[model samples]
Target: MTADLGARRASICPEPPFNALFNIRMPFIYPTSQLSLERKTPVVSTANVGQLAVDLIIASLSLQRVAILESGYCVPVVGAREDGQKGITTALELYGHPGVDFVVIQQRSPVLKVGAYSLVCLDARSALRLQSRKEEFIKALLNFIKDSKFGAVLFLSGVDLSNRTDSQMTTPTYQIRPENSPTLAGTALQRLSSLPIPKYTSPVSQEAQPAESSSSTPFIPGGGITRRILSSLPSEWSVPTASILQFVLEGDNRADAGLLASVVVKILGKEVPQWRQPGSWRDGLFGTPHDQTLFG
Candidate 1:
């Protein structure tokens, strides 16, 4: 699937302006408030563990919903609110407190992958549409960071634990910064370098490294679009971008989420508040206990 998607993507042209792609909706207005989004940071989470970590952050901080991003790139989804609110939630939304210096983007659905529907015998037009959606999504996100004048952007994701090498066994967390990042050196992001966490080393063999690796982008196995998204950001933009990665396997990851969230808070230089699990997690997050009677 990766190879197939790569081949299709190679022929595609660059993305157009973001205004032509999607519309952003901010339903709640704070007219009399002193809240300002300018120069604030944005913590963007990918699917899986990253999403879970963002969920923990939102609940812990008691952040408010700020915006709903409408994009065709993600698979359509709707579910009961994670915050135990009265309404349903969509695939993508933003949350933040006016007093906070950072906003969190919670992605509730995975981005559409053309390979998943390839076997469905999609027509050429349909295939093109799928590919465009992904490109537009990335472009829209990058454009948002630029338009909003964010101080910096942090991306979060999880890599496959099985891909870890001997050296990586020491720590479950790692980070990746764009090679020669112009904006990260003097910023708070620079503090991440002093932490115990090591820089992410791609597990891909030198011989089989993809073309993107030439630009010094880390290949993150099972990280879902993280590498792709980071690679898309040009260093000249100087947005002080960095990604925090956790090594993880499938199944219960609540503990992993908590640990990752702590690391993120440390990087952001924020006080770690008492942890609060989202209400949605109470709904059989670990699944129903096995019936003891069956063992008899």
Candidate 2:
């Protein structure tokens, strides 16, 4: 029998209630860590929280962003790859020279810039070694974002494309938000749909799923705690967010990055700069190394 997609969705990620509280629980078993919460703050410079000056923040919570950087170029890494935190200090790098001028925040997470947008190459894996420091790191990251006064935040995540199909569709996998429509949420979704990439359709086939499961909690699976942090931002903050998750077959994802970047630029009412074409991306290093490296 085909299990309903809504049923599978509810089992996977329940919708948070109107007055729901934050779920501080970690979903996976973490190895022991020596660092304490206080020690983690030094990685995040409280001095220049809003220095980015960009109007939008684009993030990848899948943690693959780390490997793409470790390879030194946008080329695909051969062998098995995975996601999640590596270590505390391992997570902090203020200035990175991985062929790109990516600014490290809170020690390990990296951020790059394109015109008015700030692309956050977040390694969700690093947060694992944080231990009791997770909450503190999240607070610091949020404060830094708040200081930026960005109009909106967009999280670009990757979902596993195993067992089933549609890996090459180029459609975004999931978008997280409250059940009821906020004006900004509606506007953001509408603008995002206007982008030229395909998006996931409701009611996936039942044979595609592994099995039925249940979870009372509502959350983003691969996103790690970053989703929780983004979801918990208070309403008064007025910074709307849209997380565009794409499906990948576990290799180089530069093509996915290009599709996501284009969607993001469109959502922000900006054009994909003419120089970002796939043909020129290899030589147009400043354009988008993330995408160019994959197909260029």
95: Cα error in model 2, Å:
12
For each candidate in turn, the TM-score is 0.79, 0.40
Model 1 alpha-carbon drift over 4 Å, by segment = 1-35, 114-130, 185-188, 209-213, 284-296
| Residues 7-38, model 2: lDDT tens digits | 55455454442322243332121213222221
Report how far off residue 160 is in candidate 2 (Å). Answer: 1.5
Q: Which candidate wins on TM-score?
A: 1
TM-score computed on alpha carbons, candidate 2: 0.40
How large is the C-alpha RMSD of every model relative to the true structure?
8.7, 18.5
Per-residue error for 271 in candidate 1, Å, reads: 1.5
- Off-target runs (Cα >4 Å) in candidate 2 are 1-131, 163-170, 178-182, 185-190, 193-219, 273-296
Q: Candidate 2, clashing residue pairs?
A: 84-125, 85-125, 85-126, 91-107, 91-108, 92-107, 92-108, 93-107
Error of 1 at 263 (Å): 0.2
